[model samples]
Target: MSREQVVELIPALRAFARILCPQPENADDLVQETLIKAIANLNQYTEGTRLKSWLFTIMRNTFNTRYRKREREVIGLPPDSTNTLVTQPDQEWSARAKEVYSALMRLPDQYREILVLIVIQGESYEDAAVICDCAVGTVKSRLNRARQRLREELGEAVED
Candidate 1:
């Protein structure tokens, strides 16, 4: 694909990157880096595949690589960091949200990725399966397991 075509797809790429990277700045950087890589390796792209799918695959791979690298480099926050302060108006809701988020974080990467792709990002099972390079059944199974794990972590009773 040409650079202009890639440029036109930036909005969609940014949306996907936003969910992949919680930080807005990091999402922007990921999108930029993905575009650069796409342009650089344009020759490797197959003509039959959808460009959006190809681009999402590249973005996902780029995010995964960056996440692995960042995992090795940890910067500790000082005790007085503003993030330590409670700024929420509704402390009850905030606490519950934090608890759920913590539970979500505890799930395995495969489960978490599927949940994020299907539930959070509103992608269909087929689309998520394509993005994850798995079958639709695998996506459904992972999502079900992820939800069960989250419930277990949160101490919620599992229901059929």
Candidate 2:
């Protein structure tokens, strides 16, 4: 992969990884593993295959393996239960914004990822599709649905 291509893929990888693992550190680790694996297997990548999708697949696969391992572990054995149920901060600033942000946060992680990719980041429909490992039409449809849900939750611009 070209240096610029790798650089461009970083944000997309992080976004996809974040959806897989909510913890920033775990997401970063996933990204690191993805980069290493992608580079190591770069020769296997076909010229026409979408690199973003390839990277996302690697990230997702890594997360799934980690998740499955965690799931398979015996639950009651861990004594490290201190703060196992970490909570979101109660941001006391601007109640309106906190409410709106919370609503957006409540969006299904899949929808939130699409919203971040398409609307917040202003990525092209095609690029977002590649990052999301879906078709261009699917990306467009998800973006529309996410926008509608955000609007509904924020109670603005309700249309027929």
Candidate 3:
């Protein structure tokens, strides 16, 4: 892919990175690392392949690698820090967003990743399957099950 084409994909790449990472700075680092790797490995990218899917695969792999590394060297916050971090609800939307994000975090990685791709990021099932390295049918099944789980977690009635 050309540099200009890669530039065009930045917004979508950043959004995907954000979904994988909770911290803004970490998400930014992931995006930067993704772009660097893409640029360095540009020759491997075949022409006519989906560029967005390619970038997303790189981002996901990068996140997985970093997540595993961090898991080995985990850090702990000070004991009293948790109490200090609690905030009174300043707005309804923010509170709701927190609840939804918390629920999303509780899901299995497979379900959460697929849900973010298809439901939150608005990617079609085919495209999501490509990014996720799964079959289209698998993406559909996971998305359906993920939605059902989310509904249960949020106390919403599941329709047959």
lDDT of 1 by residue, 1-160 (tens): 6678888889888877755654455778899999988988889999877787788888888988785355223212354665323221235567788787667656787898788776766677887888888999999999999989999999989985
- Winner on TM-score between 1 and 3 is 3
Q: Give per-residue lDDT, candidate 1, residue 138.
A: 96
**What lDDT tens digits, residue by residue, belong to model 3 across residues 1-160?**
6899999999988888766765555778999999999999999888998888888888888888885355223213444554323221224567677777668767877899999887767788998998888899999999988998888888789885
Better of 1 and 2 by lDDT: 1
After the best TM-score superposition of candidate 1, give how far the Cα of residue 157 lies from its true spot, in angstroms.
0.7
Q: Which regions in candidate 2 have their CA more than 4 angstroms from the true location?
A: 3-12, 47-53, 64-97, 120-122
Q: Candidate 1: which pairs clash?
A: none
* Tens-digit lDDT track of model 2 for 1-160: 6768977989878876655554456667888999998888888777786777667666666766675354224222355763332223245758886676667766765678777766555667787777667898988888788888888888888784
lDDT against true structure, model 3:
0.78
Give the Cα lDDT of each candidate: 0.75, 0.69, 0.78
Best by TM-score: 3
State how far residue 118 of model 2 sits from its true place (Å): 1.9
Q: What TM-scores do the predictions have?
A: 0.66, 0.64, 0.81
